[model samples]
Target: MKNLVELDKNHFIHPTSSIQQQQEYGPKIIVEKGDGIFLTDKEGNVFIDAMSSLWNVNVGHGRKELAEVAKQQMEKLAFSSAFSTFSHEPAILLAEKIASIAPEGLNAIFFTSGGSESNDTAIKIARHYWRIQGDTQKKKIVALKRGYHGVAAASTSATGIPEFWSMAGRLMEHVVHAETHYMKGTQIAIQSLREIIEQEGPENIAAFIVEPVQGAGGVIVPSEDYLIEARKVCNEYDILMIVDEVITGFGRTGKMFGIEHFNLQPDMITFAKGITSGYIQLGGVIISDHIHEVLKEKSKGTLFHGYTYSGHPVATAVGLKNLEIIEREGLVENARVMGNRLLKGFQKLQEEIDIVGDVRGLGLLGAIEFVQDRSNHQRFAPELQVAVKVIEALHQRGIICRPVTYEGVDIICFAPPLIINQYQVDTILERLQDAILDVRKQLG
Candidate 1:
């Protein structure tokens, strides 16, 4: 309470926040506790966490059982090496559980500290697999524009937004970006993705990495046919389909993995965030049977790709149990139901709010865009900082929601925990509506 803000200003370099602004205002609100869908601030003001702590925390905060799981692991062989002949019980069990819950044939799990590292690892493994199989020419990786993979060199190259890749030019060579489903021409948006395959020349393309629903790129959920067509193209050219499930996995998009919603089976799926629900850092790459075999047999020698904490016992233990609880408590099904409720609630707001442009989401993940004129589909100017304004207004109203910022478009994004019920859903929508009104008044 006493200049904690000053201390934060002195230290803490916040991600995606203005350094000058933080020095001026310091930390906005410090949350003291979270239970289920409600988060209580230091001042005891409670509100819904609409963004689910940067779109992770699938199980929500303050799960005593999860704490116990972490504690138990700490008590029983907390640290162990998954590298070269050493393994831990929790890590092994967690791997088994992941194999069971993941898509058919995603039996191998290579761990990482977070999504960025997981994706980086995936690219290395993919290239390694190809080179050993005498396909060194297949190093060309294709990703969708406006896609958000990670900020690391390799994964950042897979990231579609140029804003993330500006200072660092061409993080990964031969990484070509294709037209995203959201930014595509109408026919391409609605039609299949065959044109992309034709243009990129599938022979030179090694992998096509995509998110089931583009997360940081504004929750852009492509049509089912688009993903289906992509899978066909990958198969035709023998290209690996890498589904970056960093945001869409673990029931946020209503399914275990976003790829599960479609018929396409990815050769590799990189997962993070929800695996440990933002408690402990945890992530992994789920590889299909074919890739696994190729990786094992055809590898020139040692694959030589891993982190010190690749399969940290504590993280894996929590991740395994997290999946277990999501299944046992039927949180995924709840996300589907409550997500519909949240969507309808937003649509009702869109009816009254002339500025609202589009509203789309699944399960616990959703968002609504704001435009200058809905009728003409005119967007507000990028200089206006509309999304940032809405986020600040929401903070004032006590709820926490993230805004997806494009070149000029403002989309209010929400991906609360899957554990939220209908009542909590209503509360989140109500607070968001209030915030939207405040932002509109400010703009006027």
Candidate 2:
């Protein structure tokens, strides 16, 4: 294992990581096992997975049913192409089950490997639909300024994080980014849609994509009427509204899908992360029948877009079992109850901690922004790395949380597994409180 670590240090390259840190330190924490909401590291340390292992793992870890289903499906049909007319039972049934649970109008499903692929697939579908209707000029994808899609070409272009662009070199063309919801109040945020559409000319815009609750953008929850109003604007301008539910889907927001919270059905919904509880790589874009029918009538040939594992039988089968486990265990209701508990705890922390500012959340998705002066809502110097220090402290105390540094603000976010109990929530809150106190003392 020591030799293996040295080998990994010499050869392995990680995504979204500091390569220098990895090469020098040789992997900070080597995770060995996960059971429920706890992860066991190589040194026998157990840590609460507060971020649900990257905002997935809704059914928690060590789900034997998922493994059993994957085994059975692999024995039956290990690999198959979803290209052309080829199909499988797991793929077909999972799509039907997803349609039943998805928002009212979204009934069609196109599977992918994960969130980035799902988002990029949605972008392609939007452009193709417009082209099929003889509007080849309508190809622009407008996303909110701070919204995060994924790291793929089209997804990264649609992402509003500037740091991603700094490293990703040139992005795809005709992708327009609009003002974020945080730039102004709800009314102005909604109006920014119209402003962007007008400025860019609606005829050139094919779709407007956004996260129902901006997760990577510091869990920015929009106003109650934001999505409803945005839907109206899209309808007014003949633009398709694409909702990225990658983090907010599958009971992350106390509902099956985040769009349900707003009472709006989107033209296309890109989802991942929680679908298979991180047991397998699975994601998809659910399109509305209206859009599907339009393509049926207007399109001439094959859609000309698919993945090697678009609808892998094993992944879909594991997804079926994962969804079943979620339903049987009532994890969604647990997320609602436990999320309320977490939010109330953070609110109390805001009262006790001077740096804690603006605790916000829905269901298991929550975050606490750190500020230099809470009263003034002033951010700490980026060099201070306040959020990073707090999260590292939490890690030492056997808790895991994500540090979000975007747009000059620092935040520590939480998205614990839906199966987390009240006692576990208390443990996480207490550890977090201690970590914050420690950070404050060090700062002073």
Regions of candidate 2 where Cα sits further than 4 Å from its true position: none
Stretches off by above 4 angstroms in model 1 are: 183-201
For all candidates, what are the clash counts? 0, 0
* Structure candidate 1, residue pairs in collision: none
TM-score to true structure, per model = 0.95, 0.98
Candidate No. with top lDDT:
2
lDDT of 2: 0.91
Model 2, 1-444: lDDT tens per residue? 687679779888988899989888888788899999999988789999999999999988898888889999888899888898799999999999999999887899999999999999999999998998899999999999889999999999999888888885537998878777873768888778889999999999999999989999999988898889899999999999999999999999899988888998899999989999999999999999999999889878887889999999999998888888888989888899999999999999999988998899999999999999877789999999999999999999999889999878888899999999999999999999999999999999
Q: Candidate 1 — number of clashing residue pairs? A: 0
Per-residue lDDT, model 2, residue 121, is: 96
